[model samples]
Target: MHKITIMQMLEKYPELPPISQGTVSKIEKQFRKRGHVRQLKKNPPNKLSDDQKLDVTLMLEENPHTSSCQTTSALNISHSPFSAY
Candidate 1:
């Protein structure tokens, strides 16, 4: 069995737009793993639970002047949990 090189594959398809060797390798790896590569993987987002949301909301209501950094730090969170969602 002959293993085709990335450069060889790229040369075989001149119609393809310019792409990096690393990108080719990633595409080949994805294709081999999933049998196709056109569709992307959609992972579930990381969001706060209902209870966590309530806690944040209540905290904000109690102290409207709290800075973003102070709020996150006080809640023991590294990032702004509500902003991402």
Candidate 2:
């Protein structure tokens, strides 16, 4: 069974109807579980790696007074995961 990474989806399906990252992730999960080809299995969106997250975290830890919003900006996080949904 071929494992499709998130990066693959965004690249291959440029014409796929616009969808949210959450939705794309959800579908990818199912596709992996079923070991099936997904519609968006090519050119997936850019996702942050663990290393990137760690780098962001470390940067924040180094600065005590950094605002969460500012940190997020510095980390290139488009949306605040902590913000109220």
Which candidate number maximizes TM-score? 1
Q: Give the Cα error of residue 24 in candidate 1, in Å.
A: 9.5
Lowest lDDT 10-residue stretch of candidate 1: 1-10
Q: Give one digit per residue, the lDDT tens place, for model 1 in 13-61.
A: 8788656667767888888999998888697766877876777778899
Candidate 2 segments whose C-alpha is farther than 4 A from its true place: 1-48, 82-85
The alpha-carbon lDDT assigned to residue 30 of candidate 2 equals 83
Instruction: Name the regions of candidate 1 deviating beyond 4 angstroms.
Output: 1-42, 78-80
lDDT of 2 by residue, 1-85 (tens): 1134445655788776545667767766786788875555577455666776676668867997887678777777754452321
User: What's the lDDT for all of these models?
Assistant: 0.73, 0.64
Task: Kindly provide the TM-score of model 1 when superposed on the true structure, using C-alpha atoms.
Answer: 0.46
